[model samples]
Target: MSANTLRAECATPGTQHVETGHRVATRSAVLRYPSLTTTVPKEFVHRASVAEVMLTDWERREDHRFVVTAQWPRSHSFFTTANGCHDPLIAAETLRQAGSLLAHAEYGVPLGHHFLMWDLSLTVLPEHLSVGDAPAALDIDVVCSDIKTRRGSLAGFRYATVMRRAGHVVATGGASFTCVAPHVYQRLRAHRLSGAGAQLPLTAPTAPQDVGRVSPTDVVLSPIGQRDRWQLRVDTRHPVLFEHPVDHIPGMMLLEAARQATVATLGEGVTPLSVIAEFSRYAELDAPCVIEARRLPRTEHEEAVEVTGHQDGEQVVRSTVTAAASAG
Candidate 1:
């Protein structure tokens, strides 16, 4: 149909597969699609660089179900892990891009619309995340639920995704978000829209090794002279975290802050395997944001921590990170 729209042809069970543009073949449980050779349009994922787009292709199975494909490089500039496992945040970003792509390509959302994330979570099997010699090919089965609409335009929805690598389950996660038109987003944001506000001065960051990060630039927490407490480090100049200009701190950045805080709280030799982050309000860049972590009751199997971000005396984000001793 249109360039921005996705066209899919479904095949019935026990029929010879036909390939044209996009084909969907029914398997026992998961649907299969043709091998994807290129990434989707960068705009669909709301990314400025094509190198940053993780979604390769998507095919709608039903009104609310879809199958998507993606490829992860053996090494990533920002998502690399010192523990020799693929960064779990890579799964988080892939899930995020899948939702954004589906909203624009399948659900008829305009490109200029804004999606506000309410919560995002991912749980991964660490064994399935090791970096191999070749790039990782992922098949994601996604189901959209709690669909909402207003004035014939998508308003919000919740989605759950199961990501698989080479027929083995790698990660499963879900998120909920609401879409707002450009004018409505402007009204809601008032003067603090993207690229309009100034950020607080960049503070000295904590040691990268203490946070499970190899690069100091990747550390998102600054020392506050208190145990389990630090100030949020917003480095807009960062190439990966701040890939694009924005008025306020991004939810992904806050998630990274939560991850680092958890790592710092739990000490060394631990790797975060599960992360759950909920956003109550935006963490403004102009004001200082405080990040605090408290160890949750530890279990025999895994240790968990609760991290909270506060800005201007208000709670902005609360995250729970569960980490186990890394085998590496």
Candidate 2:
């Protein structure tokens, strides 16, 4: 196997400007950057997006695998809450980019198009990674063994990312995404973007602790006076969450709701070891949405929790969260 090294600089808003020479490379083509922007085609992300581009460089090893480096600015809210450890979304975003890079760099897939996310999953072991005090930066390496695509539909691939501090593996998990044409994605987001958004009917915002988060500003779903359920609060005025405007509830927020619901299911705090989430349709902001988590039968390998979100009576999101069977 052959490997290439590409380096560049990162200049995100809160990044610690290190004088140490670090080359951030995205592709075979190398160029200097006046500012840090995403190498992934803008079209790949929704017009209004929340993906924080953490990995600034790539070193491709093969079509199925690559070793990438990401430096998380200590001040980045998207990657961390009260805790310093890198958030699950960080890994999610990393896996997302790996698929994008593989499709374009390895498979010759063009950019400036769109892809649909059919499913995504990850497993976290607390002992495997340090979440109490996350490092200022990370060394992320990803590998993909199975990738599939067709001429007129979505392209899909399964990938895993390993985070290392110094030279030891701290955390690892695998996930998958399916790509679709711009038209298909637009069609899926159409109803939510129709400018018919309605103010969500819900109670006052609850504390982040109510949802397993340590920060109050991080809470988006509040209790709805229902057992084991929460009302989705689309606070467009939030800074970190609504950094900009959005048409509907971000997929990540919904997933966070699931994470919180998992906490409710277990009563005790939980570090999700495995999660499988699927989206059936756009969860509209104007409509009322409820998220529910159901306890699952215990397995020899892990304890399971299942989550679902609904708009009115229609199901929008479904997820299964599992934690390691042994105590951490």
Candidate 3:
């Protein structure tokens, strides 16, 4: 069947009559089908492919709730020299997309602006999930709990997300996002609310801790206390810092910035082998920050370093980066 026809059939209601053991009975029920069969729009599909190496299916559970399922295909692009997970941001972005889908489904609106994931804290569970050519599926549940205005006219939502694989918790995290009136969002919101503006109250969190100033050229080249390890820092306002919108600063980009800083700290002529990161909090824009690293104890063949990002006297991100010497 054509995609459109299949979608219509799935959405249409059908009546069914049943006979119980004692007597005949009639009831109305709405048939529900797997969201995978409900193809995602072409634009969204393309966006998903480019944003992350994954595909997602979304189903509306209620006016304010949605279930999003995502599958990440194993490929060379996601592999590392160490042969484990290549990028932690892959999972982080997948979880972000799941939350975005939930918001769209709940509000019956299309995403208007790019999402800025202001904060994320994740722990790699003891159970190692698969990292291979086969596809791995994750079920995500999201909820918006607080709404607030900040940094002038920006409206933000505090979101909580839960991720699962094979009925086991893989990760759970929260984030804050500001909504903008983009063409798609405007059209969807108009259709859903019939042109009436639905205003939700704002709920802003307390101010974050303050770290020291970070300079754009603050490169550590190598950790002061360890060999083959490095540390560095960057101001958020640096030109190279805001180049990629997809990374969403403070979220993925900040992690990359931290990684790059660590590489710089390793000084000249060193290349990274792998990087594993765990986000802890938001790193505000235009704020001064500090990054520190030290060599971790490793085997003869592998080298590792412990890296930390701090802003306002609080630790925002922690990472472990490993690399091999050019000749070794």
| Cand. 2 Cα-lDDT | 0.64
* C-alpha lDDT values of all predictions: 0.88, 0.64, 0.49
CA RMSD per model (angstroms): 7.9, 8.1, 14.1
lDDT (Cα, 0-100) at 32 in candidate 2? 37
Give the top-scoring candidate (TM-score).
Answer: 1
Each candidate structure's TM-score, on Cα atoms with residue i matched to residue i, is 0.88, 0.72, 0.49
Model 2 ranges with Cα > 4 A deviation: 1-51, 81-85, 104-112, 131-137, 150-154, 187-189, 197-203, 239-246, 298-302, 324-328
Mark the 10 consecutive residues where model 3 has the least summed lDDT. 204-213
* Candidate 1 per-residue C-alpha lDDT over 23-101 given as tens digits, one digit per residue, 9 for 90 to 100: 6543523453443277888999889898998988788888899989999988889998656778899999999999998
Residue 133 accuracy (lDDT) in model 2: 50
**TM-score computed on alpha carbons, candidate 3:** 0.49
> Candidate 1: deviation at residue 132, Å?
1.0
Clash counts per candidate, in order, are 0, 9, 16
Better structure of 1 and 3 per TM-score: 1
